[model samples]
Target: MTEPERRLWQIVRAGRLGFKFQRQVVLAPYIADFAARSERLVIEIDGETHGSDSAYDARRTADLEARGYRVLRFTNADVMTNPEGVARTILMALGRDPESPLSPTLSP
Candidate 1:
């Protein structure tokens, strides 16, 4: 894994996002950076190398989508500079994120 991948993994591993994430998941032809199998969500951390893989990346994403998986991608800079934002976006994509970061609502 790249440095960015390692960093993001620290945030999402061990059911941190309320879903168990596996690193370097094999989805047949391509390996995903991180995947929550039950949720069918794939998170890809793109590094400098991906600058030349745009077309390939698109095809990969399309194939994953066809197989009913939602793919989220983040650049290395995004992870290194704004990991919180990346985590928040990923949490939102999981479809269970709260609207605000405040404490959970209390029962009446």
Candidate 2:
């Protein structure tokens, strides 16, 4: 894994968001950066190289969406600089209600 991916993993692994996530998972023809299969959500971390590959990324995201998956993308900088924000966003995507209270501690 790249540095950003490895860093993000530390925050999201082990059902930290109240859902399990798999790293480097294969979803048929495409591989996802991280996926919560049961929730049908895929999180992708894009590096600098991806800036030149928007078309390919779009096609990949479309295919995954076609398969009933919702894709969330983050740039490497976003993950490395603000993993907590990313985690919070993922929780929201997983239907975590911000208005409701959660455990003070993040661990599940």
Candidate 3:
């Protein structure tokens, strides 16, 4: 993992801010960031490489979504600078109860 990936892993491993509410997973050989199985959320940390190939990223996102995963993207700067807010965003995304709330903050 790169430095930013390592840092985000640390934050996820901490289990604070309702992180423990879901199981955080790291998918290899295809994805490098984090994913929560219960919520079907995949978090991607974008770096300089992302700027060069947006079409590829869009395809990856589409593929993951096809597999029932809701992809949430964040730049490396966003993760490094404000991980807590990112965590909050993830929580908000996870908080949506499909059986109850129709319009949660971060549905997808």
Candidate 4:
């Protein structure tokens, strides 16, 4: 993992979102940045290096999805600048009830 990836890994591992999410789950040599097994959420933090391998990423995502995982991708900038929003987006994508305190409202 690069510097930015390591930073996001720390955030997720801290469990600041009050959810039980794990960081750096290694499925062979490829390690997902963050993962919530119960929700089947796999979070990937993309940096400049990702630009060079779009096809590879697509294939990897497809394989993970085929195994019933919901893969969420975010740029390093997004994670560094607005991590709360990223967390909320993940929660919303997992069908967390908007009315619940844990769910952030969708803006118009």
TM-score for all models, in order of appearance: 0.89, 0.91, 0.72, 0.76
Tens-digit lDDT track for model 3 on 4-108?
776666666545434443323545336536777666778888997899889988888888888888988888888788776676666668773323434323211
Candidate 4 lDDT, 60-106, residue by residue in tens: 99989988889999998887777667666776676765347764332
What TM-score should be assigned to candidate 2?
0.91
Better of 2 and 4 by lDDT: 2
Candidate 1: which stretches are off by over 4 Å?
A: 98-108
Candidate 4: which pairs clash?
none
- By TM-score, the best candidate is 2
- Error (Å) of candidate 4 at residue 46 is 0.4
**By lDDT, who's the top model here?**
2
2: Cα error in model 4, Å: 5.0
Local lDDT at 1 for model 4: 71
Q: What is the lDDT of residue 96 in candidate 4?
A: 65
Where in model 3 is the C-alpha error above 4 Å?
Answer: 17-29, 96-108
Note the Cα lDDT for every prediction shown. Answer: 0.85, 0.86, 0.67, 0.73
Residue 3 deviation, candidate 3, in Å? 1.8
Give each prediction's root-mean-square deviation over alpha carbons.
5.0, 2.0, 6.4, 4.4
What's the number of clashes in each of the models? 0, 0, 0, 0
Query: Quick one: RMSD of model 4?
Result: 4.4
